[model samples]
Target: MAATDRAEYCGIGIRGVAIGIDSFVWFALLFVAITVTGVVTGQVETGAQGVHTSLSGTPGSIALGLWVVLTLGYHALCEWRFGKTIGKALVNIRVASTDGSAPSLGAALIRNVARLVDWLPSLYLVGIAGMVLSDRRQRLGDRLAGTTVVSD
Candidate 1:
């Protein structure tokens, strides 16, 4: 195989913005889905007093399942197929294999699944720490998946 040139990794600043955008997209989707599901199932009650959401029983289970699938699938599928999520596209960055190819499905899954770990203790504090500490500007997911976030 031919040797690939090193990638110019994106800084935490831009990456942060990209993730912020992506977070909004996926979380919004999840929120809407769960909200509609709750209302449709009579699990979400709104009155003059306040709004109450009951995420228990079948409806709760469905919401939980949707949360897991949508969160994981959004990142994994987008990176695997398009090399970037909506947020990354907006910021003009992309995730690519260190070998200078598009990230494979396996790689995207590994990275996005690892996102659970990266999200520990707060809003991506661990991921930010990883990016700060690593010379390659990678979070845990990127390192495990052998991928990098680079200029598009």
Candidate 2:
């Protein structure tokens, strides 16, 4: 790819904003599912009693597990199928290896798996700092996976 195809920054700021938006949406969906389940179960309670209640019901566990599945599984599937997330699509950006090709499954998994570390210590400061400091705008995960986020 031509140098002009790249930007001085990898657009992590924009990606962060997109992630915030997605998180809000996911939270809303999860809340709705939880609410619906509670209503159907007729298990609604009031005040601090509700707070003390445990979500140990099988249905509740399944719903919670599905939420987790949706979050991680969706990202993996989207990266494999479209080379980006919905946010990346909106910004016309994609994640690829430094070689300017789609990242391999191993690379993608490695980068995503390292997200736990990138998100360490609070608010993804480490990841954000790495993106800002690196000449290629790569976060720690990107560096580890030999990947880069680029605009199409």
Candidate 3:
């Protein structure tokens, strides 16, 4: 492909690293949020208490769900406003359609929702693997949506 095409495409290799970095940052943020919530709530339990706590539907699950929503919202808003997430902005990368245009709202939402498949199980290993192996560095979502992440 031409340099311009490459610039407008993620090409598996580069996008893999970017996705890895993004996942690490997101997980770190989630961890911090959970820790802070625990501290604030004074609900830190020990041994069997911890097991029981989880069995009883821990507040952490609610917080985690909220975090997921907020994170997706941030990504959607940032991509709409600036074509990148903070991490993507820092790395000079942007998410766009294959035609070198910003993705539409429907496309963005579809891509992110498909992230469930990309993030299967945990740690985003599936997404990372797919990105590394795919021609366009796309996870399942990007493939399905005809979108791409590119260097801006």
lDDT of 1 by residue, 1-152 (tens): 41125557887899889988987887787787688778878888788999877677788788877787787898899999999999999999999988879999999999999998998989888988999998878899999999888888
Worst 10-residue lDDT window, candidate 2: 2-11
Residue range 1-152, candidate 2, lDDT tens digits:
64424533456777786677667657865776666566666655668545322355686886686666556655656666677877777777778778776778877777777776888898988888889888778889889988878776
- Local distance difference test values of all predictions, in order: 0.86, 0.71, 0.70
TM-score of each: 0.81, 0.69, 0.67
| Best candidate, TM-score | 1
Better of 1 and 3 by TM-score: 1
**Model 3, runs deviating above 4 Å:** 1-8, 11-13, 16-58
Please list the residue runs of candidate 2 whose C-alpha ends up more than 4 Å from where it truly belongs after superposition: 1-9, 28-69
Clashes of each: 0, 0, 1
What TM-score, to 2 decimals, does candidate 2 have? 0.69
Q: lDDT at 136 for candidate 2?
A: 77
